[model samples]
Every structure is written in structure tokens, then in C-alpha cells.
Target: MTAPEWIELQLQLPREQCELAEELLLALEASSVTLEDGADQPLLEPAIGERPLWDLVIVKGLFAGDVATAPIEAALAAELPRAPLQQRWVPLDNRDWSQEWKRYFEPIQCGQRLWICPSWMAPPQPDAVNLILDPGLAFGTGSHPTTHLCLRWLEQLPLTGATVIDYGCGSGILGIAALLLGAERVIAVDNDPLALTATADNADNNQIAPERIATYLPEHLPADSGADIVLANILAEPLIQLADTLVALLKPRGQLCLSGLLDSQLEAVTRPYQRAVAFQPPAIEQGWVQIAGTLRG
Candidate 1:
């Protein structure tokens, strides 16, 4: 196993220049170039509705040489006007991260009551509420602040035998947690085929009752069936688009938990929801916000 030498090239450009930057990078034959908002930084203070700002990330495999850098620089010069660009080198080893990061995935206690444990980890003391989970590709390990906030809110709610709709059900963590928290049944929704398959595998791993869980994709969400709780942890843009659908899936007075949004993104994400339900200030962690509210009757 060889150590992986990595380089992260970060550049900030006007939002308007995003496409041009992407086009230029592709012309340079860079792989997996990512676009992000500098505003995504925690504690980033920016004006509301500010546009024309974006961050471009171009990563090159180590063997890529000075020849690559020259072309990339020329491309950037042609596209972006003297903006901020950063390039840094990182040293990494071949030790499998699957095992390295796996150690951090132990049983987590949330809301003074709920316990989320990987199937391979020992359950908390019997008196404590336990929810079994296995890592999946999508998201929500109960470790991220957004998920933790949701778990805490779940403890404070009365979900005894209530049906739930777990949107963007990554790792099936939230849905499985809901069941262990006393939801009668949960319908987990995610568009990723792998996520859906993992959800089923996780449900089986936890020995959830045969009829206790059902999983589906976004396009397949049943129009008429609603739930007592709607839990979604995707980012803001998608959440706003799904606003009407999410509200529609909630029975009158049904509850909703929205997460995976940064503090900077809260206003955009919460606007539509606020029109339908009164919500409290979000639970904040590491600059991410998770909001909970009850749907209007």
C-alpha cells in the first residue's frame, strides 16, 4: 500500500464566473472538480440574497505535474479576474480509511434518552432507548450536528406508535431511530438505489418487525398517504423545492424536522416552512442549523 500524496486547489470566483471556471477546468482535464460557496464556511457573515459568489475546487492526482499547473493557471487567468486561489499539498497514507473513520462510529447518546448504535457495537444499558444503525453512503450517522439536533427533538416529542415519513433517509438512521423511539411504522424515502437497499439491509440487521418499515424513492412517494412526522435532512435548495410536498405529507398538526442546512442557509430553508408552520430557532452545532415545527391544522 502506497501513501497517497494529495493536492487541493481552491479558488474563489464571482458566482457569475462559475460556469466559465468549470469549463476552463474541464479543458485542463482535471477530475472531480467541485463547486462550493465560500459562504459555506461556519460563522461566515454575508449579506442576505448575495449572489455572484462561488468557490471552485480542482483536485489533481499526485502524478499530475507542473505541466498540469501551467495550463490550469492559464485557464484561470483567461476566465477569472485576479480573484483568490489557493493550492496546498497534503500527505496521506494507504491505510484504509474505512477502518480509520469506522472507529468514530460508535454508539451515540442523544437528547438524554435516545441511543444510536451500529449493529456491530454493543447496545446501551437496557433501560436506555436504543436504535441500531449501519453506515450507508448517503448521510446521517447521528454524529453530524444536523442529525444530532433531530435526534434530540425526537426525544422531546410524543411519537408513540405514530407513523413517520423519513425523507432523504440516509443510512435509514432517522427512520430506524423513529421506530425505536416508538413510531408505529416508518416509510423511508431516498432517490439513491444504494441508499434504499442499505435501508432494507439495516432494518433487517436491527430485526425490525417484518411490517414495521417500508422504503421508497422520491418519485414514488404516495400522494395520499401522510405521516404524523416528516423528517428531512437534505440541504436548503432541495428542501425549499420539496416544501409543498413535505407539508402535504404531514397530517394536520404533524411535526417536521429540517436539517443539513448551515446557519447561513437557515433563512432560505425556513422561509416556506414558516409560512405553513410556526418554528423555533434552530438547534445549532458547528455552524449547522436544524429546525423543528408543527404543521398548521
Candidate 2:
């Protein structure tokens, strides 16, 4: 089948001019806009206090194939008078948008026993524990190193009949994994409603009981009654801020697994919870760290 083509305008502009450039493109009826480093700088996910972009940025915008470029250039010239700009129009061939991710997101095995299988792919090991998850807008697919750290920790934990709280649960992957590994039930919490919905849908897709996984917004979460295991795979700043809240959700001598932090930020993230959690040496993967330990009474 033939792919649809869009006209993409690539604008090489100073980082400071990106904001005006994006606004101008959007106003010019560009369907979407994206940015890349014009100098070939390697970009990582932005973290607390981290710089996200390069000094020279290539701001690319996509428009309908028939859309005229004259107005776009005119708007750029008028709006960003002082900033130097280089622009080019290119044909952007769009492939099967629906199947694009499948090429990269195949089945992933986190640990010895757990296999994260995409819905369309059969589990490599029928006898092994398999999590049927399809990639979505929500995070966590056993892809990110942070998620891998958390999943591996969960896989190794003694979770049979244990209760778990998946703090900041993205796609419910961590919680669903706990259940698959014999957790009795799970409380999945996230700030985004879309994440909550995805978690619930994924839970159902995994054939977990409707009542086994409870989804809630942070404010809507039940009072912290505590659980045998608490898993939080969120950013370092939030982990530090929510240290007390998360600790309060841990039962006496309960286990806690924390990720979504860099090896550099590990000390700061562990400081708040240090007094309460008897943390073991952190596990590092691809510059990401997982801080896991038992909560003190």
C-alpha cells in the first residue's frame, strides 16, 4: 500500500528563536512540529534541573502536501527578524502509522521469568509468566532502563499473596507484573487520567480480576493504609518530595522499589527516605538507578 506524504519544513534556527518559530508554524496551519539538535548533540530525557535542548535547533513542521510555503516563510521572516534562519521543504513520507512502533517494540524479557509480550506477538515461553501489553501514550513497556530496574526488582521479590501499591503507575505494567508474579491485589495510582484508563485496560487485557487492580488519581487515592510492597517508578524530584507519602504507604518492614532517577541524582533522591528505608546498594542501568530496600517501622 502507498503511504500518505506530508510537506515538512525544516528550519535551522537559534535555540532562542524556537518558541517564536513553533508558534509561527502552528499559526501557519502546520499539523505538527518537532525539534532536533542542529549540531548533532545527543539528547536524553530531561530530568530535574537538566537542560533539554542544544544552542542550535532544527525545528521541523509538517503541513498538508498542498499547503503553500510562502506564508510560512513570510511569517518566520516577520516574527523572528533578528534570528538567523535556514529553511528547506521536503517530502515526508508517512508509513503505516499504526504499525510503526511494532518494528521497534517487540517482546522484552525483564528478568529470568517475566516476558513482556506485545498483544500481537505470542509469548516466547508459554510456561513462563507473560504480560500482554501494547505500547500506548502511557509509559512503562519494559523498554526504559528505569522500568527494567523496577520490573526486575518486582520479579525477584517474594510477592506471593502480597499486596502492592504502584505509585505513579503509568500503564499499570509494574502492578500487573506483581499480580502475574502472585501478588494478591494492587492499588495503581497516577496523576494523569489517561494513565489510569490505560492501566485499567491493560489489567483487563492481562485477564486479571476486575477487583484485583484499583486505579485512582493521586487525590482520589484511599488513605495510606500501607502495603507489603510499594513500587514507585517516577522522577527523582517527585520521589524526594513524596518520600514521606510513599513511606507512609509502606508496611512495617515492607519492601520499596524506586526508579526514574539518574545515577548522578541517586544520592539526593535517597536522602529523604534514608532514615526510613534500609536501602541496599542501588542498581544502575544505562545511567538510571533503582533504589530498593525495606521500610523501617
> Evaluated with TM-score, which candidate comes out highest?
2
Candidate 1 local Cα displacement, residue 287, angstroms: 0.9
In angstroms, the error of model 2 at 221 is 1.8
Estimate, for each residue in 161-231, the C-alpha lDDT of model 2 and write its tens digit. Answer: 99999998989999999999999999999998998999999999999998999999989888855789999
Q: How does model 1 fare in lDDT?
A: 0.74
Q: Which pairs of residues clash in candidate 2, taking residues 3 or more apart in a chain or in different chains? A: none
Q: How well is each residue in 48-119 modelled by candidate 1, as lDDT tens digits?
A: 123333344333223232234565666667667555455443443544422444676888899878888877
Top lDDT: which candidate number? 2
In the order shown, the candidates' Cα RMSDs to the true structure are 7.6, 4.2
Structural similarity to truth (TM-score) of each candidate: 0.67, 0.76
Predictions in order: lDDT: 0.74, 0.87
